[model samples]
Target: MLDAALKQQLQTYLERVVQPIEIVASLDDSAKAREMQELLQEIAPLTSKITLTERRDDNERKPSFAITRPGTDISVRFAGIPLGHEFTSLVLALLQVGGHPIKLDAPVIEQIRNLDGAFEFEVFMSLSCHNCPEVVQALNTMSIINPRIKITSIDGGVFKDEAEARQVLAVPMLFMNGEYFSQGRASVEEILAKLDTAGGARKAEELSTKEPFDVLIVGGGPAGAAAAIYAARKGIRTGVVSDRFGGQVLDTLAIENFVSMKETEGPRFAIALEEHVKHYEVDIMNTQRGAKLVPGKLIEVHTESGAVLKSKSVILATGARWREINVPGEKEYRNHGVAYCPHCDGPLFKGKRVAVVGGGNSGVEAAIDLAGIVKHVTLIEYAGELRADAILQKKLYSLPNVKVITSAQTTEVHGDGKIVNGLSYKDRSSGDTHKLELEGVFVQIGLVPNTEWLKGAVDLSRYGEIEVDVRGQTSVPGVFAAGDVTTVPFKQIVIAVGEGAKASLSAFDYLVRSSVEEKELAPTTAAA
Candidate 1:
């Protein structure tokens, strides 16, 4: 049945576009076909008149639309539901009718054209995940470039049963035919390779693949890889599931103090941890997300688009996102001159003038770090004084190239559309405005915890950080938290890693105690 609101929306669209296109439904019921035809006529009145055509043969049925207008060449043919990447098909059909080619990057276009044959793709997605949007866009782009790819998208909440049956735990899963291809957000090149491999892999081998984890971790960041190592070494089955294989650690440039290691980069430290964890034969499901979390004594963990992993417990090592400077043009010049992590994007501004915003310890530390690399470092603080420790403040003051501008706030960001050239700021005390020309701006403003999903799952501090005890036990029993998401004072990578280890150990001990208590009550239940 057509809803009244949808019928009204169709009418509005028809009035706005003032373009008429033919529509035909292939359903066997004559009344249903007539209803659909009437709905389109009400929505797109300017197009060629809608007509109901009866299907003579079920096998030969095809929904066709022909657009014959001045300066427009359009044709649409549909054999199945337009879902997943099929959303692109709908857009392309519109473009073809409109007689305009949608421009796309050459690399992405080339990847799509390389597909061997008609491939079926089923993607289960959640609207909440950050990277899922990118996956959907890429899939749509591929469909626009080529018509050989069949795509379907299923909303995780709406199609819970089907998703569970397919074992879709994470989003942006690409299922080629009936086989799972790849999961999570994939780049165009990566997806093309997965499609190629999916075509050649044996069905029996895919079904028989074994996972090595009682607890599978989906990130290689300090929390994830550390959890895997801890659980496996303690004689519990464990595995690491990750997308980049190195996690965010790969992006970190210099880690001056991670406790034991005096100096380390994010990539090197992650590699070492991976190696340490691998020595215990803990399976590493590289390039995957914990797609599904099935509840039971032995919980099942699903990957981006692959098999379910059976585990007794699960931990989220997925960390926080760096805060963005919301000033105009900041996003436009992210990699060019504006950045979030001084450790990741600082060196690129070497020997150039730079500014760091915020008065927290991270902000002060970032300014100090940039001072060593860039010709001049400007520390902009909205507060009256620096919030960093006295020691760090003294060190920052000692740096000759560093200038501390207290009670100053960045009001606007100016860029040449390619790189940030200058910025305007306001002095809180004098109400004076001044502009400074700089090559780079590092936003060392604090990070926001990625805890939007934990709506009521755990207790959070006033700052939205998870409230965990010293032992890392959260308000919830089976659920534990660590790292930046927790209410830990210092937001250092080393501190986060240490907390992750502690949290895992605590969770492990709790699991053992639970098992013994359950066993102790078993005999009494049998007697009853």
Candidate 2:
């Protein structure tokens, strides 16, 4: 299954294995099984440490393999072809299981080693989902750390019937033991926080004890990462706190507009950005949400976990998220048939009918993408005409399995208590109600800025976007905002990056002009 270049790369990576490992496969006489066998055979020769074996009697899940050391009870399994976005996850599992040292913090490794109880985690994920690899890789790493933990990354794309039976309409759906744990993207820290009951309070207490930063950037999106790099380069104390480092960027499918780079994936871009920032001496606290902001001499950013982080100057770079339709049954049926990411959850609705709400670029793109996957795609738009670009609209209309309805409003999502059965809409022109009998509803109504948390702390626009001046400075002194959360004209990654740099520079200027410490440290001569 691997190409010549890939074989060389795999061999090089396998050279890091310090211990022998085993691949115990549970498979049947199926095409996927044969493909997996071929993949395993090709990989085994790359490293002599790998010992491959098979079982005649398989478990409930077939076409799967487990990675483990000879004497270790720990396991990391893949229930399908772990290629596509999950290829990295497969590589990481092999390396870690073969005794290659993980590059995690010493404290986190220690915590995992000392973790209590047995955890059997099953993650239903799609190979096309860029977000699933992170969750799967995180669980796999944890499984290697603690022998009591076991992680199985299941491919919903291959096991469509099983996904439908479990009512898993979203990719990266998690199940602990046998009960549903969560849906959507998650990091190792987030997963650990949920597994341990008192982890939040303990983390809060630990974070609260840190010394104040000269520049504290909240949120770890592209904008926050840029701000961090700029501030850290100035030889000042810099720190960043975010619930998720990638933000909406992780949900993004592909980026063709980013300058220099012709085309790239969002998850890859976000990782490179994070890694670039890490090259500096900046402190990054991931999986921590800043709930409230206090504007003062030493601005305090209070986290949802009750952690109080103070800084001389603050930069708000929290990005945006998919806006919900908020119609009836929308909330109740979320992940049960309603989804936001077309790329991640599109395969789940294969051979079924689905409706994409909204008429703009995202909506049209979703309808076009789903038309090839689902049986039929009904595109509903609130406006009189589609706001998508001319080419996209043309392409959308050319699809045979796609239908576009303009001047229609989504009234309610219809579900039979378990999963979505259909949807209700209203025609603006005819003043009539319409219902679409479908299995899934994909909401693509654009984005809402993640600025609700800063409501009372800063001056926000009517749409809840932080009001920033030309310098990216907010209403409050020593507090700046950037990216989608601010009043930026265009919401692009490049623009966010520039705004972030501007915000960091503005914050540094404010700190030097007001603080006695900064004044003493400031250079006496003018710019050369």
Most lDDT-accurate candidate: 2
lDDT of 2 at 43: 90
> How does model 2 fare in lDDT?
0.91
Residue-pair clashes, model 2: 0
Q: What TM-score would every model get versus the actual structure?
A: 0.55, 0.96
TM-score of 2: 0.96
Give model 2 RMSD, 1 decimal.
3.5
What would the per-residue lDDT of candidate 1 be over residues 351-439, giving only the tens digit for each residue?
A: 77988988788898888877887899989998899999898999999999988899997888788766688888999999999998997
Q: Ten-residue segment with the worst summed lDDT in candidate 1?
A: 60-69
Off by over 4 Å in 1: 1-213, 245-248, 289-310, 341-352, 360-362, 372-375, 389-395, 398-401, 430-433, 521-528
Q: What is the C-alpha lDDT of each candidate?
A: 0.62, 0.91
Looking at model 2, the pairs that clash are: none
Q: Cα RMSDs of all predictions?
A: 20.1, 3.5
Model 2 lowest lDDT segment of ten: 54-63
